[model samples]
Target: MKRKILLSALLLPAVMAFGQQYGGMWIPTELNEKEMKSLGMKISAKDIFNPDKASIKDAVVQFDGGCTAEVISPKGLLLTNHHCGYDNIQSHSTVENDLLTNGFWAKDMNGELPNPGVTVDFITDIKEVTAQILPGTENLTGAELTKKINENIEAYKKAQKTESYQTISVRSMYYGNKFYAYVIETFKDIRLVGAPPSAIGKYGSDTDNWVWPRHTGDFSMFRIYADKNNKPSEYSKDNIPYTPKHFLPISIKDKKEDDFTFVFGFPGRTTEYLPAIAVEKIMTETDPAMIAVRDVALKTLDEKMRVDPATKIKYASKYARVANYWKKWIGEVEGLKKSNAVEKKKQYEQTLISKNPAIKPTIDGLNQKYNEQAPYNLHKAYYSEVVRNSETLTLAGIYSNYIKAYEEGKMDAKNNEALKARLTEVYKDYDAELDAKVTAKILALYANKTPAQFLPKDFGMLKDANKNLGTIENMSKMSVITGRGNLNGIKTSDLNKLFENPKALVANLKKDPLVEMYGSFKSSYFETTDAKVTALQTDIDALQKKFMAQQMETDKDRKFFPDANSTLRVTYGQVKGSEPRDAVSYGYQTHLAGVMEKYVPGDYEFDVPKKLISLYNSKDYGVYKDKTGDVPVNFTATNHTTGGNSGSPALDAYGNLIGLNFDRQWEGTMSDINYDPKLCRNIMVDTKYILFVIDKYADSKWLLNEMKIVK
Candidate 1:
């Protein structure tokens, strides 16, 4: 079936059987049913992701990206994004482990280790019973409101108990305006399945992070495990794999222009309902400013890390985090500029108001609040967001003062003991070598480059002190390293000794440089993070309540989808390509062979393992193909996706996930606002490539047997 014909047919019914073509799956509310069917979807919205499908709950998986996954097989098989599982991969790798360098393999079932602190959930039910819940919520307290909502849910659950779907849950939407219940069967035996080497997985790393013409294979694998009863269970060697009710079928057919598709999994957030003015600020100011802050921080960290290897390791996690947000904010800004998302939103709002009289005032009121609130948030962000992070060294000074005071008999028992305990807990996770490196990296840049304007007036700074602390110098000169170790190594009795002498403590404070800086830095830090946070919290909580209220207002005539709330939700779009940012639309065609051409061996990030590099250099292109070519190293598809979609499945028509959507091109990063097929191309690694690595490199044939693989 050709994609164009399929698209035309699918769109035909939506436009009143006329000649106009309905766009891609842009309007989730108005899905092109006929077109979707042409592409091989046999299920309705109710059927495909129905709350009734016992498997929908069972199939769901929660990813670190705030994404979701589903169980595909009975033998503990889980599926999620390469980026979603990136942390786990990085964590399991150290100097000796080097899993990121060579990749990881259990070889046999016995070798697999369970991941700690990760869990997968299945939503049992979601429904709307607006008739039963909304009338009396106006006068209730927050807790009272929650209680009423829960009470309504309990009644529904009790009424529905005599059914086959016995495992049930109730949800209240739109604050208290609506209610629903669900019956679910959750499985707990999920485990790590497979992942490619970073050479293939995070190929371009930060360089190609938000860029298109990408060659990254961002995907990972996990499996669901269950007890013999096929019910959810904690990890145990004897647990069996779960059997999914209707797993997505696979297809080799590619999605071309205008293909009908849907994205499934929880989308972390979307403020699409915001006013035009709010959208304008995000496009013009907020994102760019935030990106600038991140850029400054990243550059500062990178410079120090590059000069000193010791500092590099300490700032590794911090660098990754700043880079991640920097990439996202940059991508979003560029995408919005190219797609004119703000302009389109303005036009959309105008049209809505022009056509509907009542909705206009409703929108007007909303826009007023939106405009008033946007800039306030951004101004607050600078001081508050960076306060804790930027002042850590200063806080350390405060701790030093307390310690020295106790040892010299200048501090009381309670204050002396408290300081030691706090410092003791913190250093347990602290890496001294890394800490020094990170600290130096931050201090050097601020000292050498930044204008004094960035800091508050009293920031007498480390540069002014010249590594010399009057009294603080003497205490730090009395080094605290001898007592370094996690909780188990520190003795409570030894902590008592520091408090016995208070004069030495008072003298130590005068020598600690960090403490000298803090005497000035403390008031401002409190002014921003603590005081401002308290102020912001009041407003944010009020907004949450109003957000709840807004949901209630829309419930009468609309099925209100919650505001993500960073909760799980499954969105469905198709494997497609778009022309969101420019004249030439995007296309779906990338091959594994192109990875070699894009490769730059020994180029830091391009430093691939000997094996995968050899495979590419040796023309081990495998059998990947496209209509006009062999395969592209990377291709862009017009699938709806966002940050949390990091580890989402790019399934084919038969529903078998053919690729994993990890990112969008830099030009289309603003896809969360308005999707433009040309620029908003989704980044995915071919399933075939994932398979090739597993079969040729990892040699894990047991996993291959579990899936219905086709050549």
Candidate 2:
């Protein structure tokens, strides 16, 4: 015991130092002020987030409910990643006016295009509500405890004082150990301001998505409009550009290695506290299963996209969304094994048990529950991946929802019209033949990979000859949901005809082959898998919460940051490169010269715009050129980030905007589950490059006039 104590005393400082340097997605209201200051932060914690007055947090908003964007000008000009705004860009693109290919620059506010449903949510306030939310549930567990917690939350929200425009939401932290209430104000009248063409904004494309030494510009610009009183309102021509409380000043000062930087955003999710067994399951089983399914889908989509320009245009956003996680999972599995995360977790668990033997059973119980849940979890992954990737089946699932509503006697005129509108949007970019081909391949792979017990009955017939495309084609053609032999499948015109007779439509859908198959799969999932998984998860969560409390109590020297749950967070580090693997040290940044090095005139991923090449030839980089005599593009930093951190502001020590957070280094994708400071790095597009593209490339210097530039 004495020797262990001495060893812990010796190691605690190093552990704390490492934690302070590279780990943690901290809550802004509960920042570790001393540690942040020690790590070279020049501003107070309150300057980053102060509910009493406007601060840096006022400028940051959740972009389109997923990514993060920051107000870069007093007139509410927004900056975020290109891919984060890809869907809207695709929506506005057409063969005649291809905004995605040629890009768009609003010469004035009158030229800006409004996006009807898109919104940016500003976090007005975040306060701990644990006392109010968890007080009445101390003696309860499982379903009863959940019920009581819901009741308490409803009461707490109802009692709060908030403006009519502001909404209150509560989220649990540390596996329900604590809670926080957020007051959010959402602005709906966002409009596109400017974006570089894909060749520039998405330079390097999928080939360079998560890799370091990236040269992609990866950014887009937008403006937020509001009513005359500067309050949130729906889109209207009468609205005006919002006047922001605080907006970040763009820092054009030369950045170097070890410059203090921080990312502020709404990070989606991270499970940093999972036990060793869960990590092993993810690395060995679940990730590989989903990857295999997406692998088949991507290969099919790539073949179609490569040969057809229209298909490429139609599927660009869908393909990116699919390929994003497909590649991330591949990297995550590799990182987990290379980092030896499972073994390290085991060692840590042993140490934790040693410190407090009483908590050993809780840890053991959590592991046991994971082991039991493993097969069900994998089945869940396979089911979800197949449905998500197969457009036909996905559409069928939507029809299934309509069928449910009809059966429940709740299919009012409003619901019917809503369904028609949804189907129209879904079928707009959908290619039935392409979906059929993808469905055949992925369904075959699913049947071959999934256990017989978990598969639906339709899949059982294909199990013996899973690769037979003829049988799959026949099965799909039998379904009216696939348009009953129509190569284009259900058209919007067909929908109008189908909806003319609601009762007949419902009757036909009940007999549809694809819908039946979808129903069976969903039924099998809920009946055979979901119930058991939910029960085991309830017990596992209870034990895990206790385990978390125990670990925090026993390991008093270690800093405990809550896992990300799509709430606002602040993760800080420095501008630095990484040696992702042996003998392969990546530089801290990439330049336009490197972009030309990778350029191929006619290649989809590497094509350079003629104007961009002309500017490069003339060396017309303007003030955005770095001291190194090149235009800096993307840079790597040690900041921790995940999915929702895309488009987050990478701020300098003085809270000036330096870069836009976009992707993580490939080897660091596993940071969602386990972070290694040495390998984990967030990739950001340098603000210099953003300004260069906007000014020199697009010749849109008018947009730059609005921003406050700190030279």
lDDT of 1 by residue, 6-122 (tens): 121122221121111222322222245565566556556454455555433345555533666655554556666666777777777889878776677676566665776666655
Query: Judged by TM-score, which candidate is best?
Result: 2
Question: Candidate 2 lDDT, tens digit per residue, 1-711?
Answer: 011111110121221224344478998998876776776789999999999999999999999989999999989999999999988887889999999899989898899889879999999889999999988798999889999999999999999898878999999999889899999999999999988899888887877778766789899999999999999999988999999999999998888767788999999899999889989999999999999999989999999998999999899878988998998999999899889999999998999888899888988798889999998998888888999999888889999999888889988889988988888877878887778788888877778888888887767666543455666567677766666544234434477777776777778778877788789878988877888888888888999899888888899878888999889999988777666666555667788888888888887778999998998999998898888788888888788899899999999989999999999988889999998877788999999999999999888889999999998
Off by over 4 Å in 1: 1-43, 51-58, 87-96, 129-133, 139-185, 253-258, 305-317, 355-364, 367-375, 388-562, 566-587, 617-634
Q: Give lDDT per model, in order.
A: 0.55, 0.86
**For candidate 2, what is the lDDT?**
0.86
